[model samples]
Target chain A: MILTEMMMKVTPIKNGTVIDHISAGQALNVLKILGIYHTTDATISVLMNVTSRNLGKKDIVKVEMRELEVGEVNKIALIAPGATINIIRDYEVAEKYAVDMPDLIVGVMRCPNHNCISNTDEPIKSQFLVKNKNPVVLRCLYCEQTITENIADYLI
Target chain B: MFEKRHVLSMREFSREEIDAVLAMADTLEPYAYGGNCNSLTGKILALLFFEPSTRTRMSFETAMMRMGGKTLNLGPAEGSAIAKGESLADTIRVIGCYADALVIRHPKEGSAQLASEFSPVPVLNAGDGAGHHPTQTLLDLYTIRKESHLDELSITLLGDLKYGRTVHSLAYALALYGAEITLVSPPSLRMPDQIKADLEAKGTTVRETGDLNEVIEEIDVLYVTRIQRERFPDPREYQKVARSYKITTDLLKKVKDDLIIMHPLPRVDEIDPEVDGTKHAVYFRQSFYGVPVRMALLKMLIGGDDID
Candidate 1:
């Protein structure tokens, strides 16, 4: 069943982005990526743990009059690898595609290693090589520390 | 191909690049031994040692001098501007103006990578805290090639696998050549889970063990690293495993006659002095290879590309 037809709980956006198929329980993280808070001025609608035919359970975020940036897409891909990004124009789906988990992630997140050079006062950007995409395993390019869990905590 | 290139980590090198370095080292053997090559005549090399080092500092200084190049030696951090709280970037930028190439050894991991950015010249990482030591790994490769073949050798890396940057760098490099590695360290100092996983994914057979006697005979090359007193957050924890794995002459008798023993030295008690007389000890000879290997690297970095 479609989200709008079943819930009748939230309204759709006129022109903006709709992040769909986010893994269940990650809607808050998606909001974190979008930098949304209670004080956010943009009209935002969040559907948590909604029933989806594509995924067993998914989260959908609809933001009115707010377009998504490339960094936001990359952040979404890291937390929720299988999520799809939908661009809506005039309440119509204009463009849609799943975010690609890039092989080399530059400056999107900080390395978990406390001793990592990127963490130092030196002017060096944290770079990571995506070792695995499903669970979002990232390896630090400089220190070579692999981060598998608590990835959301390390978000930039 | 290393012309004006900064060697920050062994992870940055490919198998072909490693072979290129080994081949160049072989070509520069005469210059390393006693012959005067004088290839880097007009070039100036800088030695910026923020930490104390014996082998690495001397080898680089010797490598450049043998090639007829001059060296600007910046002694340890205490007497320098760094003691007065000068930043690494400022120090590197200042030294970059004085030399054609810079070799740095710092206590902080990733300082070499940071130095590479600030310097106009190529930056060579002599050693960087527990992060990486690319030059040591190169010399290890050179030694491995000299003693045994780089391919399909069962190598055991024992002791302090966690904080030993040499083991970390070597493990990655050896995996490139399809070496079957057996890592033996105490529970506290085991190989980092990520490195072991990455190596396993790369098709290198990795075995983790806490016992040295069980895996000793199976190893063709015994690569040992010292369990550093400083690496342990608690000194009492280091005491538990400090003398656990020692290489003695009696133990070497039980192993293969051709089994090669290697160490990144400044040995305390991990390797007994008695083993030095045995044919198994190749570490001193291994230490000597650093000069030629570094000479090859210096030539590649600073000198022109037309080498015969």
Candidate 2:
């Protein structure tokens, strides 16, 4: 019975949003930073280690009555590009959202160089010019470090 | 069209940029070793060294002068404004106004990064607190390719893996090229665990052990590094390990005949001075190439000023 409740639990929201296809284990990190995890005002639902047809394992979060702002959308784009956002209106699926990769990203990806000004104790934005997009290389606008997409994880 | 950027870390350069720098270095090779200078006319390079440097600073300055570029040298900025209360930020901000490009060195780990923040002109990290000297790594790669033509080769990094940022960056670049690397460091100062994992993930074969003697017979390039005294908490720990790692003539009897020896210098007893006269010692020449390689770099970054 406990296993049935644990396995069969579901929460239907009146209207809000749903995020999908986030790589497992990072959804909590995403939701916590997004400020939708828990608040006195907004009801939240979370599902982790869920079975997925595409990723084999996935995470899902449903927000009862909140929508993402521009800054939150940009952060989502930078941190979780694989994630997709959907609009839930009156318990019906409404619209979807995807993060945009900006041509020149500032303060989104961290600079990988430890001695780089962007990595100092004082705050500085990690600025990049999308020099070559085919292979995806970012040139540091300040120090001239050429940040490649392969190593973007280090900066982010 | 490259213009006004700092190649602070190897992580920043893509394959395309590396190709460009290498191609330009090849073009500048003749003028670098032999005759007249004048590639960089009416340009100014300001080299600010707060730490001791022989190769990188001299090479950049030499490359500048050789290209008909002028430079202002402020060696060892300790007794300079730093002894007073002026921050690295203020100094570089002031210098950025004076120079078209700045090459800076600082002992603190993030000083170069901090300096680059406010610099109006592009700031090049000469060497920053064991963090990265990407130009040196590029030149090292340059020398290896010039010698071997093809990038991949049998190579061995023989000593001081932990503190040598050059070995770390070069090793990562080598893995990208499918070069086999044997890391021969003492157990106490082995290559960092993360780096080893990264190399393995890249599918590069890396053999790790304290004994260089066992693997000494098969390698081509014997890249040596001094055990950095500054890294140790205790001076006695450094003294005990430093002497054993020294590469000497007697040790060479066990090795192959044509092995190339290289060291990023300011050596203290790690490499015997006698090894200097031999054909294997390419480090001095390696040091000499820093200028041309960096000149190639500075030119590629700023020369596009004319292009646009």
Q: Per-prediction DockQ, in order?
A: 0.47, 0.16
Consecutive 10-residue window with the lowest summed lDDT within model 1 chain B:
B299-308
Q: Can you write out model 2's per-residue Cα lDDT over B1-308, one digit (the tens) per residue?
A: 34437767777676566777878888787778855756677889999998888778788888887777899987556668867867678888888888888898876555676776788887788887767788888898888777553356778897778878889998988887778899987777899887899899989999887877877788878888878787778898888778778888888887777788878777788898998887778888887777679878878755623310
What i-RMS does each candidate reach, in Å? 1.6, 4.6
Stretches of candidate 1 off by over 4 Å are A1-10, A35-58, B1-4, B74-94, B151-154, B180-220, B228-244, B254-256, B304-308
For the candidates in turn, chain A alone yields TM-scores of 0.83, 0.66
Query: Candidate 1 has which clashing residue pairs, if any?
Result: none
Whose DockQ is greatest here?
1
Residue A103 in candidate 2, Cα distance off native in Å: 12
Model 1, residue B191: C-alpha shift (Å): 3.7
RMSD (Å) per prediction = 4.0, 7.3
For model 2, what share of native contacts is present?
A: 0.23
User: Candidate 2: which stretches are off by over 4 Å?
Assistant: A1-67, A73-123, A126-156, B1-4, B14-20, B50-52, B74-94, B107-120, B146-152, B230-240, B304-308
Candidate lDDT (C-alpha), each: 0.86, 0.75
